[model samples]
Target: MIKLIATFCLLALFDFTNADIQADRLYELLKTKKSRNSPVSNTWSVSDEATNEYSPVYIASQDGLSELDKIVTLPGQPSGVDFNQYSGYVTVNPNAGRALFYYFVESPTDSSTKPLVLWLNGGPGCSSMIGAMAELGPFRINSDGKSLFKNDYAWSNVANMLFLESPAGVGFSYSNTTSDYDRSGDKNTADDAYIFILNWLERFPQYKTRDFYITGESYAGHYVPQLAYTILLNNKKTNQTVVNLKGIAIGNAWIDDETSQEGMYDYWWTHAVNSDATHAAILKYCDFANETSSEMCYKVTDKAWDEMGDIDIYNLYAPICLNTGLKNASGTGSINVFDPCWQYILETYLNDTVVQKALHVKPTSWDLCSGDTDARVPITASRYSINTLNLPIETAWRPWYLNKEVGGYLEAYKGLLLITVRGAGHTVPSYQPQRALTLFSSFLGGVLPPPS
Candidate 1:
């Protein structure tokens, strides 16, 4: 039954019977292929100076409450925009000299009435700025990779969006304490994020009592819920209206390793991304249920990766960016077009020194994806529940309706709701913006995704 469902999801992937032995060679090449930014050197320089002269900041009001750290205006901001945007940093831990950067966009209208939504992108180390500029924010990277265009369906249309680059080392957020990056974990991350929010509220007192929500994708499956739990815990401990965290929504989230691993291998197999022999080998040698693998399993997995070819595995059916000469080339894909080359464009635009200076970011290479993937296993291994806080394999799956049709599946264990976006990859809004917005709107309304 699971195979059938995966087959339906991946009918367009590949045909296993047509696979050839050359796949082994492809797999071998993958093993040694280094990233363009391989051997990333530590960019942190020794500073005997106590103050960072490069840090750009703004404080609009008195009492030290209303301030925008590193406030910046984007280089190519679109013309005649009604919404207000502030990009800067907020120091969460002064002793550690740890500060997290953020991009906040007020709703297009009714800034005071709309809820505040915090968007996080997970690498356990990736920047949330990607989520803001590339995925669901009000502005998108232009084809030239140096300009911007407005995203019509930006989440800011419905809510005040807050995009954060967290945990001391992701993007512009940094710590004077070097070990903070090495010591970063889900618990510390959640604790810091909670503290950051409290400090952020002190800066923007208007939203002190407004409705708030947490939303993110990928490893944020751990980041979002854990932070939400912290907010809940603190709320109860204080018996006050501090956070106003109402709900959480995650897209294409990694809930559990065992289930995700099973789903991934299943996805690859049914999509014909791997040959039947390779699939069988995986089943025999790899234990997805226990998160264990044998030597033979590793070999088979390599073959599978080899067969995956030069396509974006995240969106299997999506096109690959084979052209490296993209500087002058208006990429074949754009925000609405869902072009696969968006990543390249984003990397180019964010790393620009001018853009960096505008955002008050020190000169350092910005990586789209970073951090140790291992930090996440500890997070998923523990049980988390909306009610009891235990992570369970079998959730209460129900069909959520949107536009009177089945939009996706929704499962609620106690008060926690997990909604799976239909036909979406790791990033739901990027692949299915309309559906994602529907889910977002419904989730904020305290209802299921549209039941069409």
Candidate 2:
């Protein structure tokens, strides 16, 4: 979804947030007759999901991302579409008082029995547009982040890919209630996604029976499993239409904050990013070093949490990644725009036209930094973004995203094989395509080319 974060997003501070402006300029998005009520506000339209035409789904290869797919649009949608032959919808979120942009990827030539993959971006409010065109989708964009690029390793090659701008307040989707944005809890996000899928299937009835999978990264670690659980719960009730779901997967997932941070510190020491002396110092003073001042038995997780909390091993999100051989000199360099983790490889991937064309979003400014609310807030001056907290909060994706098993090797999870890049900070697809492909092959079925 964020594949377009850097490429686009010049003016996010638009009146899109103002209820008065929307009521005066466009259709009154805020209505009195609705259930998921929050304070009333007018909603925007689907066209607002993205600032431009570049969207999700991409095709990537050794030649990088290529751009040559049929331009298919959906019916029952608004006008001015590139292709009116396909199926799409403009989902107005009644709760948040806004509209979001969303679309589906039907089989290129056939609509036979197929699997569905929903690719989402993190940031809680980020757009999954790039997820459609760039990451694991069918095509990529040009250098301008506006045109199209075809991806050879697109996930659509194996299963149907669906992208969404969720939570009513994010992207081009809208809800009338401002309170909708305020209550963006795990349960709400999961429920909204479930509803979107149900409505989406209704819009494109052919995909109703497709075996579906939930896949994403970052905070989506929380999303995939949470949503899957909701589906599982719904499957238990009668008269409820069950969403045919397989398994769940996430990459570079911020599953359990406690373990992730501990893993990061260990990773830094082992990778030589920090000196043994400083590494020991962090461990000694560990931010979360103690439990009940030494004589209390907390939840077993607190032990791990305390250790990671004590050490600022994250270096303020600046772990150096040199395995790819791209170096960041002193001062701003390469992907060092914000954090220095995985700087080398991320910079290299952004330069590939194949990647660009495959994703279909041509970023005006390419950087290694996570949009991470960087454009809106002063992250440079602040210590950390909500992302840092979003990562550590204990959630459901924990057991699997850790890539290990405690009670058993795991459940009968037939979801996609998901893996997090060892050194990547954010967006593993952008930082570590090779590992992403390897895991993709392991979980799914394919021969992903090693990154060039």
Candidate 3:
């Protein structure tokens, strides 16, 4: 019984009245989850055979023309920023009039030396701009809902960060063919994102040979691996390193359907969010591996939801915004802390005409994660998925620290690294920015977190 927030973009859309209906829709989607049938592997090795030739779609000369997409400055951005910012559309399918919108930020100090990390935020329908604006991006929206402040822990400090609003219907990306929207799924998303990256590299040719990594959270658990696989296959097919992909990482990911569902219920029970009887009933009646469940299973799951009450299940201990209607007021917490009402403030800022013009997006309504922290995708789900892999542990779990304070725990597997933020929720960066940044830096550096 996984309850979802309907759409992660609901907050961006500034619509809350039909949240329950959206949650129901998400639950149904989860119930009918389709198996991608893609193989799961602990290590993904790219082809060793190489060629000097580039993809037929890539043209080095197009690099100079990318200035057309350069962003001068955001509407309310702080001054003294040194990094270059760019945002615009890249046409992935000209015939279908399909284009994906992206925002690119170079590292402030070493634009040429740093690796390029492409980030996707999962909604399957949500925009990645949420990552850019609310999570690991370079700036944070101020409480005033009209200005921005620098995020000291922004990921751009160590890597050239690219955030994409993917698929045809999400965010500013679009396809003129209305039927294209109906065709959205895992395969289509991976294919379109692949094409988007190919075309994007042509625009920024300097990064063509840069070490590239894919990262995301939530449903991106699916998107990141799928896209990485696509990149590998295409590279092997062409015998060329079309995209110099290195690795991928997902946080609080929803990787496997059966394990994720089972783990969700288990997490709820262990966390004392549900009654003992409801947990027992679920364990007795639910068949998570099957496409359908017993009627008793549904009844118990619904009961579990009722027992949980109105808490932010994402970060169970975090406060819920008592005043979601304060669209213009400044939020209560600082940039490093989670502000329950920050989404409302961000909605007002992004919806501003000036901001839209600056970002080069049309005046369409923006959306945020309405169901981002839903019970459907939890940290426990990720843990279960990892267990299914059963990779050999290279390093046993140990506490990781930052500045003499315990930040999280880390464990290294034969081909995977598992790290946990002590108090983070579904969106790790939002709840623990500094710790999240340290994790990201360590991931890029291929080193363990400080054990002290």
Candidate 4:
């Protein structure tokens, strides 16, 4: 069951096959949307608001030149954008020639005063650019596939956002030592990411003491926590607060192997994706903690998958993009008007030579996840993982609101909080941007979401 679920979810989310399909679909969509005479405007501007009053303590810093990585502009970016953006490689292991890529976006209004957030997208091998471009980054690719539009709910609007492509093999990050790629795993990935952070701070010294938070989704469940642990261990050994590690927020993450698997099947069963007979077989024949299963367990799960049919498991109710290039035909009754083919648009835009050169990236093909929703690391998996911690509840689970509508439910544990985004799949922000932003704001503010 474990192996099956991981293979199904991870491959569906990160496999190159889906990326190719999405890219082709994007071209078809663009052909229909682009106009010859009145071209889409590339220039966009957001009015500035007053400087944010919630400021963190600042420490005096020595100047470090980061001009080499500063992005003058991105291809087709809106003119008059207020914030500074930088992207480049940070060498984590010089001896091995292992380097990781990063894209940093400063807060638009009060960058110096805002906290720093590091965002990772987890495949254990997936690139963080997915988070930057598709989820909560400052820009969204236009249908023309060569222009950009602003993401109004960009996390950078309130925090200085840092996106990383880690472990020296994902995205633009690379290692001259070929064996490093094969050896990359959780421990090494976490260590290299920590080194990347240290080296990155040297390049951008002003942020060394900034209040920092880590966030990610899916396999990042492992990346975020492991990296945070490394940071904490180093700080404890040095007896000094090195990174100013503040907090971490993981959305629909896959943290534990056992609970996540159990939760996933439970979720499928409870949500009516699997038959009761299959659920019974799983419970009777599968041993999640032991990491063993009978042949019957496999048979039952295969049956479950077949019964689930062609629906997007990530968002149970979202429309599925068909091979025929159809739109809105799945009829899943989703809450958000999610573009089933958005990944193709992103891949088309990012793979453009002009866009790569402007971002200072080497020419390489970009791939996307299979679907936009969150079933890969389902919410039920998160719930089960949290339950095992056995922490005392500080607040009862209750519905949280956005614009007077129920967004999701959240429960505050002694040292943690678990919040869900209603109608969100594996990727919360992509499915419900406004609600994700609301949850993010509440997290950074160290408060609960509005319960009223």
- Among all candidates shown, the one with the greatest lDDT: 3
Q: What ranges in model 1 sit over 4 Å off?
A: 1-72, 239-241, 289-292, 327-334, 372-423
Error of model 4, residue 22, in angstroms: 14
Consecutive 10-residue window with the lowest summed lDDT within model 1? 1-10
Preferred candidate (lDDT higher): 2 or 4: 4
Q: Model 2, 14-112: lDDT tens per residue?
A: 111111111121111111112135343332222333233322211112121011222332111223332112222334344343444454665554436
State in Å the error of residue 102, model 1: 0.7
Native-structure RMSD, model 1: 9.7
Superposed Cα deviation of residue 329, candidate 2 (Å):
26
User: lDDT per prediction?
Assistant: 0.63, 0.41, 0.73, 0.69
* C-alpha RMSD for every candidate: 9.7, 15.7, 6.8, 13.0
Off by over 4 Å in 2: 1-100, 287-426, 431-442, 445-452
Model 1, range 282-368, lDDT digits (tens) per residue?
888877554244667677877876776665555555555665445565433355576456667788888999998887667888876
Ranking by lDDT: 3, 4, 1, 2
Q: Write the per-residue lDDT of candidate 4 for residues 243-346, one digit (tens) a residue.
A: 88888887767677678768777877887878998889889877667534456766776686677767666667777655433232322222235566666666
Among these predicted structures, which one has the highest TM-score?
A: 3
Better of 1 and 3 by lDDT: 3
